[model samples]
Target: MVFEKDPTSLYQIYPTTVAVIGARYGDELNFMAAAWHTLLSFNPPIFGVSISPKRYTHDLLMKSGEFTASFLGHGHAELVEKLGRTSGSKINKVLEYGLELLEPRVVKVPGIGNAVAVYECRVLESRSYGDHTFFVGRIVGLHYDPRAFDEVGRPAYDPVLYLGKDVYVKIDRSRTIEFDPEKFRK
Candidate 1:
């Protein structure tokens, strides 16, 4: 039997890779792990990250007009959790976590050096939706660890997937399969 409940319990989309959103404005820098991010477009390479106004990274992103989204492997789940739980206003997450910063080729903001992939983006627009502000950015530069992906661009490394409520998981590659969509078309 199917069960339904209030919309507030809508965290069904759990196994999503966490993207570490990094922002820098002048001398200030901060990083936050966000599961609420996605690739919005392919033509212009637009990406969106949702952040609450209360977050310090949100303020830096507004001032800088640029940011970096870094996707790390499953091995960094602990680091991701730490970054997401702590407030950047009260602590220097990068310095406290001992994360290495990587220089961006097109934006002022840097990315986590150990990231599997990083996208340097310039803010295209920002809109408030409920409690969070959705920032859309046009990707200007991309960095990736070639070994972490297959030739066709499929992830070869185990990505850190958030299971909500401070839980994390990784893909079981042993169960992975490749299929042709046309085979299912009747």
Candidate 2:
């Protein structure tokens, strides 16, 4: 198997906005928006989210060792940017944005209700990689709006996707296509 240099440009990957909710170390609570989140496993339900040490939310997650991943819903593009740009050490991002919070059953950190889905997670492991730390969490509790669930029980909420440098997108679920490696690689 061969691969080219790191060509995973911003245009190459579909983006999703995630609200990282956790308790601050000393006091207070914090929830920051993140774009670097992905599912790592399904059996134990684990997710991988990368956070920079400079981010105030990072310190909180590190201290509590638990957090929530809340998916952003429509009309939330501006809120995501606002939370990502501001520092919780100086300002209360949740209160500033008028975001509603819900107490999770397993964690002290609250989950954002604005999102279609919220995964209440406990940190299973953390590893520092380069300029950021990646946290692997196991999902302990999950919540979502029933209206956002489709007839098939899948989430129907259209997630707001982040494009590098400041662009937002929503999933075009109607445009899915089946792929065949042999047909396209030749």
- Candidate with the greatest lDDT versus the true structure: 1
TM-scores for all candidates? 0.94, 0.82
List residue ranges in candidate 1 displaced over 4 A. 1-8
Q: Report the C-alpha lDDT of model 2 over 95-180, residue by residue, as the tens digit.
A: 78787887788877788767788898889999999778999999999988889888867667766678656678777888977578
TM-score for candidate 1, please give it. Answer: 0.94
lDDT by residue (1-186, candidate 1, tens digit) is 223545436688777899999999999999999999999999989999999999999999999899999999999999999999998899999889999989899999999999999999999999999889999999999999999999999998999999988999878878978899999989
| Whole-model Cα lDDT of every candidate shown, in order | 0.93, 0.78
Clashing pairs in 1: none
User: Distance from true position, residue 158, model 2, in Å?
Assistant: 1.5
List the lowest-lDDT window of 10 residues for candidate 1: 1-10
Where is model 2 more than 4 Å wrong at Cα?
Answer: 1-11, 17-19, 173-186
